[model samples]
Target: MTRPVGYYVHHQGAGHWQRAVAVARALETLGRPCTLMGTLAGLDTAAAPGPVLDLPDDRLDAGFDGRDGAAERPECLHYAPLGHPGIRARMGRIAAWAAQHDPALMIVDVSAEVALLARLLSVPSLVVRLSGTRTDRPHLEAFRAASRLLAPFPEALDGGAVPDWVRAKTLYGGFLGTAPATAATDEDGRIVVVFGRGGEGGALGPLVQAAAAVPGRDWHVLGPVSGTGAIPANLHLHGWVAEVRPHLASAALVVGGAGDGLVTAVAALGRRFLCLPEPRAYAEQEAKADALERLGAAIVHRGWPDAPAWPGLVARGLALDPGIVRSLAEPDALARTAAAIEAMCREAG
Candidate 1:
């Protein structure tokens, strides 16, 4: 039986881990053994039976405040990449861990360096990436050296910079999570606002002010409303919930910072969205927003938070087309990704 070891890169969110878990489940259904690797926020191992190889806490993307990514984006890049010294320090230990499992294939969710190591050992590997962002240059170089690169979302949706070979392996897919999504739309008057993990702390204040300005509608927010004072009379605040999709599905529309999770989870549900992208942040998020806006999948807003369209934008969002997400989330998406990986391995020979 073929054995695959899945590696996920974690920083501020559990996206990589979530996607990897989905892909691993698909592999299992095909009668292939998969072991999960990496460390991420709230990644509880109790949910699955695979042996876990925890990665070190590498805070690579926690760059600066979410509001000032424009001023800090350059500096964020200059900082050590996530796969730097920490990974090297632990490789020997990682190698020993690999020895115990003797995995034949390594399925990585996002790390490019794991490609380098997999290469050194002549082990086959596959990469899983978010929908909107293009493949990283370092990762593309790594992908060329690997057995296959499987994209979970449509190549037409994003991944613009990816080379043809890797693109050939792209298999756009639906979410892996099996839990039924619970959208809150029946509460017709409510407006839902989602802020990503990094969007906490200082950014919440400005967003709270913005939400306050638009109180003509009932407001609900998820993830971070701390220090913004008692939840505003118009807003309902809840801590992070495992099922965020239903909230988007049930809402009139969505407002949030540009992040992988929102792009896949919410956009897949066909909600109209507005991206409050971090100012000086990763090009990927900004670029993803750019693509989405061009495709009319969502709206992109940055700069003085009080732009004239703020209210009208909210109005238009409330009028977004419904039931579009079902097409984006075609059933059997994860199954297709797993099948593609096995096909890539056969081709590599």
Candidate 2:
């Protein structure tokens, strides 16, 4: 009998779920049954290749935060709030699922606690590693517990900071997302600005100023934004769109944070990128931006530059080499990731 593989998708960002679906579909093609488990509220799970398990939300109630149970949290754990029924229920559900399925492998999109839990349950887990300085106790322990680590970007972007042991235990799956198709020609010299849901949206004031500064190029803003004042004639706000690929494909240059999803998409599409990395936990985006700039794949800035600086920045972004960015997109990444998981499952059996 072919034992099923279990994937625990993190609910914080769309990237986790996006990668999960892509990987699950690849696994299906390989004849490896897989199940995805996560807090599925507001997510479109219709395209998932296998059964979906919606887990309970483990966040604390309103008015309470992570600091509430900071002292009680174990040295090796990051988030474990006490007296939360949701947390208890969430872990209980995952434990129950493991007991029922006896899964050959558990793939954790990212959660130190959950990876540790799988280890406790005697299920070998493969953890999806994210970029950043993740050398803390909880992260190190989780990496050690994992049977293997999966880095979704090319190995060159790692910056060679991780310990020798982690590098040895990892499988570098370069950019696991939808491969880019031939992009439409950008006759209008459009500049597309994107903001992801994982963090605060872009500020409209700076965007307006930028658009006004660069009068020749039209700026199309996607996703949410804060602040409202005068709207620039050249700055068109579309808010959140159902699809961003069309806008991205027709853009002369792209501006956004250094998130895994946006970066992967830009790389795959061979678009020029102006990375304004937003602040994130463990300085994830900052670290990624550093690697991108170092590799000549993007033009990075610390923060939103003044209106006077926008013209030069825009020119620099447009001048970047699309071929360098496209090189980071491994066309066979999804297949390689799925094959690695299958091999690990076979070894376990």
Candidate 3:
């Protein structure tokens, strides 16, 4: 009998769950049923071909009574507030599920403590890699404990940021969740502005102003864009849409936060993008946006541009070749990732 694969998705953003679903689907195609445990909504249990466990939400803002009200975690761990029953219960649930299923491999995308817990429970695991400063003890410990590390970006763009030890165990999977680009009829210079679920939205005002200045062009905002400011006649707010890939494919220009999902999707579709990376916890988005700028896949902005700066930013973004963005998608990216996970399962069996 083929042993099932287990996936632990972090609930920080929609991106983690999105990536998890793709991975689970891939595993199912490989004939290895997967079990996903997470607090995220909208995940299709049916997509996994196995049980989908909706664990209790353990986020800091979940308003659990036991929160320490402080940002700092124990020195050894990344994040586990003191006396938080939710954290304990959350980990306990994962532990119980793993014990009962005895999965061949568990994939975490990702949490340092949970990755560490998987190893402690004598379960083989793989942890997904995030960009930015992750060389600290907690991150290093998690990397050391995992059976393998999965990097979602292209190998060509991987500078020496990841340590040699970690890199030796890492598999660069190019960009995941890259859907085939749909042939777009002329959008007539339509621009899509997306601010991910997380991140500051102060830039929305300037972007609205920019849309007003550019005549005959339509601007669409997707995801959580919070502001009480005036709306431009040419601007359309879609809020949170079920699908964003098609929008990216058809857009004349795309602007948004430099979240991993956003950047990778744009790269895959080969769209002209202006990336304004909001402040991320580990500076992950910042690092990604910088690499994209250097690679000519995107034009990175430090912040929302002033009135005068908007026109120039838009022009520069449009001037970039979308081909550079398309080059980041490797043909074997998704296959390689699925194969690695399958390899781990096979080895365990």
Candidate 4:
């Protein structure tokens, strides 16, 4: 019997969750039955589209922040070390779930334990990556264990010293965000206040201050919002939009943390953005923002930069005419990635 396919994303950041939704939504469109399996957070992402099997995330964020939060800094990344008996028990339950579900193709996003579960279930599993891979021995072992690896970046960039599995799966143009929505043209040139949903303290407050300093620009926040003071008559608190690409397309500039989804979305839009790499428990975002700056995709603003340089930087980036930053939702991205998976399934059969 052919099993249904599923996408598994570890619930860490919103990026993996976004990809899980996009891919699952596309599979549904293709008349293919697939389940999204992961922690409650990841399952919640797929809820809007279809069904999911909620499992636990080993990378689960506890109260700990990144290295900066500690004295003498034991670890730079905010990782909740697994191996607690609870994690082992959860892993066992997850393996049992996979045995019950028996998905034909398990497309795992950066999760070792999930990949291991797929292996235990005797199901063919594929790996999908966005940014860089883990250099650690365990991470490399996890990537190598997958049947196939896929890097969802344009082939033109970052072709390098990654292992053979990652290189084989690396394909370009996998912009995993919402397709470019029709910009609210009437509100063109407005400032987008991206109300970031981050656990990290000290980031959003300064962004709010810097935005307040700018005059005459319409400000719109994206997620959970709080704070007081005259939210300028021009500044609008748009709590959270269901789809932010339209707003990104319409805005003169977007102000937010260097979120992977936002980075990929804005870069795909080819818009001008000033990234405030939030000081957080983990510097993962800080690292991503730095990479983007080097790619000439965005400016790593120090919360705020000197006023004089802002306009010039925006002009230079915007003038590039990035056009529409298409995503997996587009037929092409789906067709390409799906084709790879389908071929693997057929071969397995």
Candidate 5:
């Protein structure tokens, strides 16, 4: 009997779950069963291709404040708080599922502790590699523990920063997401400002100022915006839309953070991107922005540019070659990722 594959998705951001769903669908096409495991709160579990294992939330809350101080936690672990029932229950549930299913492989996208747990359980695991400087003890140990590393980006995005061994172990699956079926005509002088839920989005004041600076252009904001002053006539706020692709498709220039989902969508749509990478753990977005700028795929600004700088930045972004951005997307990325997972499952069996 062919054993099912288990995928542990991180609930922090939408990108992880989106990638998992895409990969799971591809796996279904390959006649391989997959089970998604994660905290189901706020996620669309119905989109999952196979069985869903909703794990207990392990994050620190007022009732379950078990987080350790920075200096007190183990060097090999990123977050292992003590006396958290949720964490304990979450791990126990995972272990129980693993024992019951005896899955051929465990795909972690991604958690160091869970990867280590898979190793302890004698299960072959594939860890989804994200873009960033992940040489810390915890990340390195998890990488070592993983049977293989799956990079959901083109290898060129690595920028040759990682060690030779890590590159060798990783299979670059390319960017995984659906591109727009048909290119929507770009709305001339329309600048779309996008934000992902993973990080604190762009400040409303800066955005308004930026929009006011370019009075001729129509500015549209997607996702949450904090801080409110006076709303500009040219600036429009559409908080957290269900479909960003349509808005992105119509953009003369896409301005957003360097998260995978936004980047993937922008790249696939061949949109001229102005990247304003938000602060994130391990400088993930910063590193991604660096890679994108280096690759000539985006016009990256370190922070929200001053009001006077917006006009020049907007011109630069609009002038970027769309083909260069499109090159970052692999049309067959989802299929390729699924194939890689299938191969890993076969090897494990």
Candidate 6:
């Protein structure tokens, strides 16, 4: 029997699952049977590259009666609330699945506790790299325990924050997304505003007002606009777009959070972009935006958008180096990464 590869997709948002799916597809192409386990709601395995295992929701793993934050066992991990059945069940499910399947390789995408669990289970594990300030004890412990660390972004985008020892065990796999059919050419002058879930804390109100102020431009808003009570006539609000590639492909300017999905999409399309990073657990979006800004790939606006400053930001975004942005479009990153993982599995088997 062919040994399977397992993936643990974090349920924080769609981005984690999306990345796992891309990698899983690549692994399937490499003739590896893959299984994805996650706590994400409404997970449809029909489109998955291989079998799917649905784990109990970890977010619901809070038994704290009126406690403000999550309950943790100790200083080594985070967010595993005490006496939370969901958390216990989720961890039990993962441990049980690993034991029954005996997967050759386990990929955590990512959680410190899961990576640690994989190592403790005697399974060689790869922990997916995350951006932001990750110097905490839990993060370091997880990274140390993993067999290898896979960073989904290009090596060029690496910020010097990762300790040398951790960097030694890491592999930079460029931006991993479902590669577009063909490289999308630059769009016309239509502007597309994508405010991902993180945008809830952003300046959506000002962004809409700014788009309205900029006349003679078509603006399409994608995803929820948190504070904007009324939709403007000039802007078409699309709650959620199933396939955002075409809109991104034809966009003149793409405004969105610095999440992996939006940034990678814009990079692939070679669109001029302004990154509005929202607060995250470890400054994830902020760090990514900073890197892109340093590369001249994106215009990072740290402050909330105001109508008065909108025009200038747009101008700055336009002036950014298109070549730099386009360089981030790694069409073959997933393929290379999958091939590497397959090789690792083969060696382990």
Best by TM-score: 2
Candidate 4 lowest-lDDT run of ten: 67-76
lDDT of 6 by residue, 76-159 (tens): 786566667877898899899989989999999988889999998999999998888888898999999998999888877777
TM-score of 1: 0.80
Q: Look at candidate 3 and give me any clashing residue pairs.
A: none
lDDT of 6 at 121: 92
**Residue pairs with clashing backbones, model 2:** none
Q: Clash number for model 4?
A: 13
> Best candidate per lDDT, number?
2
Please list all clashing residue pairs in model 1, or write none if there are none: 69-279, 69-280, 70-279, 70-280, 152-173, 182-246, 183-246, 184-250, 185-250
Misplaced by over 4 Å in model 6 are 60-72, 181-183, 198-207, 226-232
Would you estimate the TM-scores of all the predictions? 0.80, 0.95, 0.91, 0.78, 0.94, 0.93
Which ranges of candidate 5 are over 4 A from the true structure? 62-67, 70-73, 181-184, 227-230
lDDT of each: 0.61, 0.88, 0.80, 0.60, 0.87, 0.81
Better of 2 and 3 by lDDT: 2
lDDT per residue (tens digit) for residues 1-349 in model 4: 5556877766655667777776666666666667766665523452437766666444334753322232332222223353455466656776776678666688887566566667767877886654543555545655666787766554533424466656764454365555555543433777675644443322345445545566555667677665555554655666656677777777777667776677666766656666777664225566666666666556667565555555554555445333333221233764667666766767776
Model 3: C-alpha RMSD to truth? 2.6
**Residues 39-89, candidate 3, lDDT per residue (tens digit)?**
766554554455788887676664544334677667657677777677888
- Best-to-worst order by lDDT is 2, 5, 6, 3, 1, 4
Q: For model 6, what is the error of residue 158's alpha carbon versus the real structure, in angstroms, after optimal superposition?
A: 1.7
RMSD in Å for all candidates: 5.0, 1.7, 2.6, 4.8, 2.0, 2.5
Predicted candidate 5 versus true structure: per-residue lDDT over 1-349, tens digit per residue: 7799989999876889888988888998899999999887987788888999999988887453334555587777988978879989999999999999899999999899999999999999999889888889989999999999998888888855688899999999999865565575756768999888777676898888898899998999999999978998999999988668888887889998998888989988889999999887778888889989988999999887999999999989988988898988888888778888899898987
lDDT of each residue in 1-349, candidate 1, tens digit only = 4655545444546556666666667777776667776654466666554666676644434553323223333321223343356556556555666666566677766655566566666677765555444454555566676666655555546646656666676555555544336533453766777766645423456656666778777778787655656556776777677667777766776787666677677655666677666542346567666766666667677743673456877876656554443445556666676787656544544
Off by over 4 Å in 3: 41-49, 62-74, 181-187, 200-204, 228-230
